[model samples]
Target: MPDTLASNPEPAETRSRASELMALHRAEKLLTVVNVWDVISARVVADVPGTAALATASHSIASSYGYDDGEQIPVDLMLEAVSRIVRATGLPVTADLEAGYGDPGETVRRAIGLGVVGCNLEDQLKPLPEAVRAVEQVVKVAEEEGVDFVLNARTDAFARGRERDPEVNLADAIERGRAFLDAGAPVVFVPGKLTDEQVQALVDAFGPQRLTLIAIPGTPPLARLEELGVARVSFGPLSQNVALTALQELVEGVQRGEGVPSSMRVLN
Candidate 1:
């Protein structure tokens, strides 16, 4: 006999919530995601008002376990981390399934089983054609499983410094974005600091509602970003970096015979 879940579609409530989660990016306001790598961070972010969704940062998650990013961590271990994050929140959860780990279809199946309703599948080191093919397979599996998952296809040309000329990089990103979108990805994510002109060009070419970019220190503010018509804005590993940097400061201070600062104190 077929497994009940495999045969039967997701419950209406689950499906409705999934749809609502996907709709947040299409709204006028920017959908800001503070990427988390653990249950504690997941709980903290989910409790904040106006958080549309939560996504796991694969780099941070790998770092937490003493592994570098780029699929260094095993897929099972990564999905276990994702499961903990999902258990911490009722809101939609998206996992950064970096390059789909190994097999995108299998990775997505495991992600869906863990209650994830969305994912960021990056191009990573895969060539443009290969990335598009992977995206197509992931979408196919998600639809077959009746998950209706939000597949956010990530392009890493700019972030990885693939091309010498910035124009060449931008052109490649746009081309990949089109292919991914055509392959059934709901959004295309380009992570890196892009100039205002470059950002505008991506938005205009890709359609603002389907373009998602990582937020950086000097990028335009949220209000300005919304005006620019971006679908989503996310901090890939910035949150973890900020938190760790503060703790590192405290550790150094303690080593220097100085007590923790008042601002750093934890109340009982």
Candidate 2:
């Protein structure tokens, strides 16, 4: 059967509690947003005693399906992956619905049905107005559903070939960030090309209370991000790459008659 977010939807109390956990990250000292692809990874991360929450990596999901990222996967497939992840863990799972999948209102309704307490919507692939409209729809749906869904609005200006002109890129990011916030996004994620000064500037522009900064891949270390007043840090597909590298090494070692590393041996 094709996978999808549950049609029945979660109970009101469950949704509220999930939203609360997402909201609490704002005040917490550190929040590690790990990227998970499948139910196994989600379960493992959820079992981590100190993990704040879980997030899906669009690239990882797309790669898994032999496709490129950026809305390549159908909404049903994405929602199914999300549902499996939610079932694998008790913690809040943030589905990275690239470009909100389709119409904003329908996307929000479908996401909420999957029991997601948070989602990452990006403006890299869509026009600013369309992105803003989508965020607005998401906010309305979240509010009506009585779930404080954390909307992490991502601006891909820096990620999409705007590295040469720092000033222009930064300005674009700020403008997009502000638009999303105005449309009801509680967090602004500037993915890529964010320097220390740039990060601080975004924080200054948006303020810590109103907008949380989400750090993307290769941005900086968690300590530096915290120093910059970033509220949340995400590794995106880095963790998955690390996992792939480890597996490759393990396989190569075995093929070379080196045997598996003792550390990798089953505990039984």
Candidate 3:
């Protein structure tokens, strides 16, 4: 687990206000949501004046814990990551709490205590109803906490490695999306195999007033998303992977007795 934020001097009022700022980020036009794993990356992202908010990538957190992404890391590790990022920057932070760490209400209660303004909860590992229940529980917690905590509920039916029919998955996702929205999720994230037509279909089906559509990596660009009526776009774990790739290349170059490029070195 990372260091605790209790060591810092930030007050409860400030944390609550930061949560509100994070909630407004969801209503903005074309916000850039970069995923960070630790304090350094979180601080770097916060320094970007235009960055609306920060998101935690579960894969990065898992890797930092010397484990894999799929339920290998403990909930404590995830909460610690959020706490570190929140302390590292004043920017509103949204954590990717994968599957809400099992229990719905307990997860939300824990997350609120950590000072996170928003979170991404997915329906990949659990059934649709279970996911809905989890989202609803989180939303209720957000309401009671007096924070505009944006709950981004993700649907992974398309990403799941199965021979299920696309129509069935789409119907299931749509139903889950509606339930999540009714349960207080402001955004519904669809993560895989989404075409322009399908994106349009979802937007039309859900309606703009009901829920915002969020696309992950492999989806079209920002322009295409706007054209397709997508409200938000996130890269998930791609940014962390990009940083890792750069580090790997730099290390290989050094081992080969080649000096690293000036652009690649951070000379602070």
Candidate 4:
């Protein structure tokens, strides 16, 4: 038998919110997730009338601290950002807890303590077996905590192999994804801009309700993903890129002696 995480299940209110976020993945309409970096983006997204929930993008959040992704920033700072965002809204917030901070047990405890109901646990640049073990630890603690936490298992084969070789074998993705799920991951997020066929293959291998896709330009539109039966779609760092690109353009215009766009100019 598994050890109890929490003597009692989550409070009624926390359980209700967690269940609703979990249901979004099983709903008829595709769950479109907008990944936020900080409180500003989080609040803006949370205020959207049609938004379902908020997720954090580690890349964006890390960059906000002048660091590259992949745990470049300290775990303390990262969780602090998560805490602020988690506190800013009534909706469920899941964080991109990169690589479980190298300790799945403590990671689970800290995440729950911060009021997060879900999180993405990546493979942490380790072999499949190691990642599976980490996932097991996380799942064990989560169940004991009785928070109904949702773990989105992320496979980094595409990213891990990009520097050495751009080729990402679908077989590797399948093997890792299945291993994680069998270890108790509720969702498998296959990142990168895979083809419609590759995306479909993932969904077929891991049921629509269990597969999560990271959206990119090459991928089909949001509606098409729904038609193809994906469970969740995330715009990881894309929103941040868009926001930064606009600011870059504004700076360039200023450098060119062009006045600020009237739309953004403050009128005293």
Please name the candidate that would achieve the greatest lDDT relative to the true structure.
1
Candidate 2 global CA lDDT score: 0.75
> What does candidate 3's lDDT look like per residue over 1-268, in tens digits?
2333444324475466555554554453555677899888887776767887788888888998898987678888778777878777766777888887777567767776777777778788477677777888888888777767777888776667347887877777777787787788877877775767777778787765333344455666777766555666666777887888988998999999988777853522
Query: Model 2, range 200-257, lDDT digits (tens) per residue?
Result: 8888887773444445555667787666667777768777888899899988998898
lDDT of 4: 0.82
What tens digits encode model 4's per-residue C-alpha lDDT throughout 117-182?
888988855887898998899889888877777899888776566654433557778889999889
Q: Show pairs that collide, candidate 4.
A: 5-144, 5-145, 6-144
How high is each candidate's TM-score?
Answer: 0.91, 0.89, 0.87, 0.89
Worst 10 residues of 1 by lDDT: 1-10
Q: What local distance difference test score does each model get?
A: 0.83, 0.75, 0.72, 0.82
Give the number of colliding residue pairs in candidate 4. 3
Q: Show pairs that collide, candidate 1.
A: none
TM-score of 2: 0.89
Clashes of each: 0, 0, 0, 3
For model 3 the TM-score comes to 0.87
Return the lDDT, model 1, position 21: 69
- Clashing residue pairs in candidate 3, if any? none
Q: In angstroms, how far off is 187's CA in candidate 2?
A: 0.5
